[model samples]
Target: MLRNRLTRISAALCTLAACITFTACTATSEAQRQATASKPPATDCTAWVGADRNAMLPGYLLPRAQGTTGNAKGPTVCVPLLLTANQPPESYAGGDYHISEFTADKLKARWRDCKAEAACFQRVNAQIQRWLPPNKARATRSTGTVDPSGRIDPEGQVDLRKIRRPAFFAKAPYREGIAEAEGRTYTVEFTVPPDAFERIDLKKTAPIKLRGWYLEGTGVDDGKGGKVRALALMAPGGGGQLTAIQHPDEVTLRTDAKTGKTESLKFPNATTETMGQRWWRENLHALNQAGFDVLAYDRRGEGLSGGFSDTNTLEQGEDVFRVLGQLENGRGLRMLTPSGDVLEGNAAAGRLLAGMKANEIPLVLGGYSRGSMSTAWAMTSNYVASCTFDLPEVTCAAPRGLRNIRGAILLSSFASGAGYVGDAPDLADRNLFLGGMAADHHILFYPTSETLAGMHRWPAAFFGKGLWDRAESLEGTVAAYNRIRGVKEIVLARGPHSIETWPESDRRYLRERMVAYAKTVVVGGRTVPGLPRERMWKDFKGLVATTPDSWEPSSRPRTMEKATEQ
Candidate 1:
């Protein structure tokens, strides 16, 4: 039965895939030439220490960003709530905040008198909450000091010993589950930076500390063909051990073939292809604080990954695929499913093909702006399950793959046209589009950006050849989305093009829908949690009325929504 269902899903998805001619969708003839061109080997072994002795800084967390749990118990470890550093002002819940490093000694000594885990930590958690903005921007930083050798100075390590009992839960399921693979009872590794860790000084009140670090083992699969994982130690500052942090997330170093120079790639950083990678790296320290095993790299033509020639979405996909291939190459951080479960990349692919796949943990494909659309296109294969598309679909066919996709988290999906009759007749049926004359349906419209310089328009650098750069009828896409048989284009509240533009409630709501639906469709069939129907009317009005000037619709509408419904 499961196999049958998956087969059906694949068939439906393939229907979209098949619409394209072999020549149209086929990879560039340069695949062989590019394949032979040995990418500069990735650099290895550049380590960094978080302000907190034992923890690793600059790591990202999994499970989309969530807000703090007020009235909570235990130490409040400040984890990054957002993914990118250039997040919109609205991404934060709304509060005055600043960055500072806290030592383990401070945390341990603060809550020295608390006996019960709950009471002791609750006081401190509240204090930390006060420090953050209501809808806080997820803190990511690339501004830390670099050593003379150009490697990240691994000095700011989070100490674990002083971590008091009862760690606070920022997001749901805060308690670390039993280490499925293997490890100790008190798995204390990968804590946040001291600056990120804060405790409220409540006199005569028991203080709070993080609930020790969890051991995220090594050699996990990267969802393609290899394994990637990290092991590190984090602790509180105390006992003359100011610099006693050991083993941070593995810093990979490979010599550039062309440059013939060694480069260091942090496992917990985002793949630097464009400015987005820079934003991701800046937050690794913040993400590490939040208990995420972020594995980032430099894709082709960007950062350490070489062989980039005027990069496009397809080339970017191959670059990302290589990272997975690297992880599966038996080297780095592995990809997990929506449920926090790990899988061998090869096995995962095989299972996907066999239709015996399960979503134990979230294997998130996070793309910022342009990358988001690329991620969506990449998932048309068996590689990824959940993707976060940040910009509007530049091309029409990109959105067609949504039907069989396990999760589609569109930060800003593009579909601003009169209707679905522009270019690319092939995409007409794939996108869940509505007719030009249809009544106002609950369409998934992306909001225009109020921040970022080029936030409103598609970047010209991305036009390689395919539909991405080509003009397609948004009308067709809108029609496809409306009629497509899958999750609706669930719109979050008015977040600008960046997910950061929307309020945390709005972003959280969207994430909840994505995660929940991911769990059901990808993991096991189950209902996802949050969907704000009440806000639909307001959201709808806001969407249709606000036409983003950034999106230059195809000239001479083959199809467009009628200005006046009549």
Candidate 2:
């Protein structure tokens, strides 16, 4: 009956397709006939298990020879779970082999019958026991935190006070054999599991420190002797302390740029912890090695930085300006701690910034995700203030607005008014910001695949009021900024929404391009070998041409008009 029902369904489908074209009709009809005829008729006691049923069973439940030697064997009896009922017969069984053909309902009935058979049930249950552990014996209790340091006692106990935050490490897999000699490292703090916090007797302590190392030849060996070497080594504290800037609202953790070991000071609030430290270190290390100063601080209401929580605001831009000013000239800089102690500015930062200014070193501003948005706004605010009230001539509005900025690097960032209408002011600010940028100023865009995917949906749901095409949206954005001067836009083939998720190749590509662009455009240094063309607009155009499906048609010009009107 089941087979007959399937046959009827197949016939109806073939007949419907037959109306579309004679050739498809004949071919489909013949294929359906062949499939139906080949299927054995269902038996009275058993039903047919089709391809769909076979796929439903978990793969690990399939019966197989026991032991790694493959010498062990099992009973020759065919278990219904392991049988491929839809396929051609591999062996002959009692009476008619057609009895194995069972539909879902019939299969369940047969399983009940098998369960009733004492001998068969015992055999099957025994086999099942080997594959699955008994429920009562399964592990369920939490074991607390497992120390990655391997310093715990034999019984899995440890001195919690000695625990420290872990260090992170990362290496470029794309440069596995070539650049495996070196690796990057950074400090890391781990979140404690909720269950661990529930332990009554366990005392909660400050984050412990662990040192991480990324050594060559540490990754999985690929039989070919070339390993994707990447290792993270974290050890307990060695008495090192981070400098803190105490403000009325918050205390900002500061790492001196003059240390030379410091890369970029990441704003903690801008991105989530999902952007792993290893990835952050890799990119920052590359820039640091190229003789660039990197500084990171927790923005207001994030990490150690104190203040109200807000994102991409003019106030945040002001905070950036203040930080830069502090770095440039530490004179009159002071931070008041909760204990009423006044902290003076670091002379090292003042000297570093002064030297750069004296030498006429151009600054490169870079940021990821919301940080990029913040950076863009900051630059815009500075540029807008510098221009004369009604003219293009420069006039100082603030003491530090990143004068002599050579380039901007934006990664995984969207336009100001990306998802909401409230961002219109910011969007307008960006338009003016782009107009203020010099024609020779370089801007590098590193949008991930995830970013493109998100932008593809922007016009339909969020930006419906405007005319937008995926390609046109991106290209027009750069063109709006007159990026024709010097622009490099590299779309990473694979990565999560965060630029920190970029693979080794993408990271290397970005580092090389950034260094090369800075060398040629900023510092007037020698051009690095193997760098892509100075401008990526042409390559981007080629990508759009070859992958037309990736881009959507632009909406009407009314969209832009609507945006401007807002």
Candidate 3:
């Protein structure tokens, strides 16, 4: 039924203006089909990917995430939850499978048995909603006050004249991977005075200490625990539960960059016990159980750290750099004990970061949504990340190094360009995703490098996103996949904007794929069953109209020109 509604991406790409109203991968025009050919389905991209009900993960993964809800449960646990340098929708919608396809025998039958097209659509939609946990509705990004395109004014602001933005950089992925390595880290460095409530600035290059929880697992308890640790965070949860907790050195004071006024904003700071969101808590535990010590924290400005939040990828990448520096610098991080009544001053240094350099542990640079943008930023580059928003043209070339970063995991990546708006955007149900679609962040591929060394970071990667992700378009993610030139695997499933929002089945699947990936590239010396080993992805074009992602680009087109035509 969906196949009839879907058209090839080749035609969709040719029709630029209409593509915005819907997703790019699933066009609906019969005439457009004749214009061009769609890229190969995802099945052709790699051999490991099977139906949505199948697993592309290691069999040995059995984690016990102590405190989580939904699919993130148990020791044999169900499941849960990418890469960088940069960062999709559907021309190829309509996956034949569902996360619950095989599990719910009756529900699957009901969906499959109904012969009436319209009646079945209604029946399946209603039943699907009833079977899953209710989705928790979160507030969307404010369309007012701040326009990503920077087009309209706040409409209510008192003055726009006096305010200034000394620090700003073009969204990095748009440039593909040019001088992104050298651009401003887009992060601010400062110190919190125990007495004074305000923060003091040093420079951008200096490392900013971030507050997070670290658990050792790669080795036999090192008298304390293990040395080899891994890092994996949540989808773009803006701040931690301690969102109300302000950074001790918050110089920005949560002010609006445009009007120079205070805004009621908070960071995902740390508490004595909890280091991340529910999803974070679960994934952290999973990695620890998987034999890789896990280190996660409140990102700068988002939690109990200094500076402000820009939600930029390079900035987040720099944040990763700073935290890694603190871990390896021998300064010894202040750790809170498992008991709320804690201890401090590297008491677990032997277990966490004792006599060894932190870089020795191959870590995966990652994030979701805006977080994925930081993937490329974590790579080897001549340019140290610097953001001149506050102080114009300030260089932050501090001694930042994490040479052993083996891979990246980008979840629901950024669209390299402003993709399709809507087939009929004026309608209420029309998808109006912004952010990744922000014209300023509308990056495209122009980089000429096709070698692993030329990439900003190492090339081993696992890129995954949702077919239902409204924040990013399918075309945009392909652009991101195209930017990276190395061994990479791309996975598309039907879920929510963030992994936390996904159901247990989908979430469990994500965990399996993630653990498989972490074990292989981040920890090294292991190849799990069903692990993806594709070299690169081919470009795809289409106007998506809502369907599960079931296809992938072929490894190569028939000819060289066919590969580059789109």
By TM-score, the best candidate is 3
Question: lDDT score, residue 168, model 2?
Answer: 13
Scored against the true structure, residue 293 in model 3 reaches a CA lDDT of 50
Quote the lDDT for 22 in model 3: 27
Model 2, 24-93: lDDT tens per residue?
3433343333333333222112111121121111111111221111123542111111111123255733
Task: Tell me the alpha-carbon RMSD of every candidate.
Answer: 25.7, 27.8, 21.1
lDDT of 3 by residue, 1-566 (tens): 45532333223222321222223323323213311232222221111111121222111111222222224344322111111111122344322111111111222233344424666555444533332111111111121212232211211221212111111112321221211211211111122211100112222343344444455554412223334445443323444421121222222124334543333223222321122243544554565667655555444444334333233334455456545555554243444333322333344333344245566665666556555555544442212222211122222332233556666776766423222211112211111112111111221111101111113234566667754344444544544454454445566643434554344555566677776776667544443347433212233311121112222211111222221111
Q: What is the TM-score of each candidate against the true structure?
A: 0.32, 0.37, 0.45
lDDT tens string, model 1, 135-214? 01122212121211112222223232332211221113322222121221121221111110111111212211112222
Per-residue error at 489 for model 1, in Å? 4.3
Q: What's the best-to-worst order under TM-score?
A: 3, 2, 1
Poorly placed runs, candidate 3 (over 4 Å): 1-209, 219-236, 240-276, 303-313, 330-332, 339-351, 380-401, 415-457, 523-528, 531-566
Return the TM-score for candidate 3, rounded to 2 decimals: 0.45
Candidate achieving higher lDDT, 1 or 3: 3
Kindly provide the TM-score of model 2 when superposed on the true structure, using C-alpha atoms.
Answer: 0.37
Displacement of residue 537 (Cα, Å) in model 2 is: 5.4
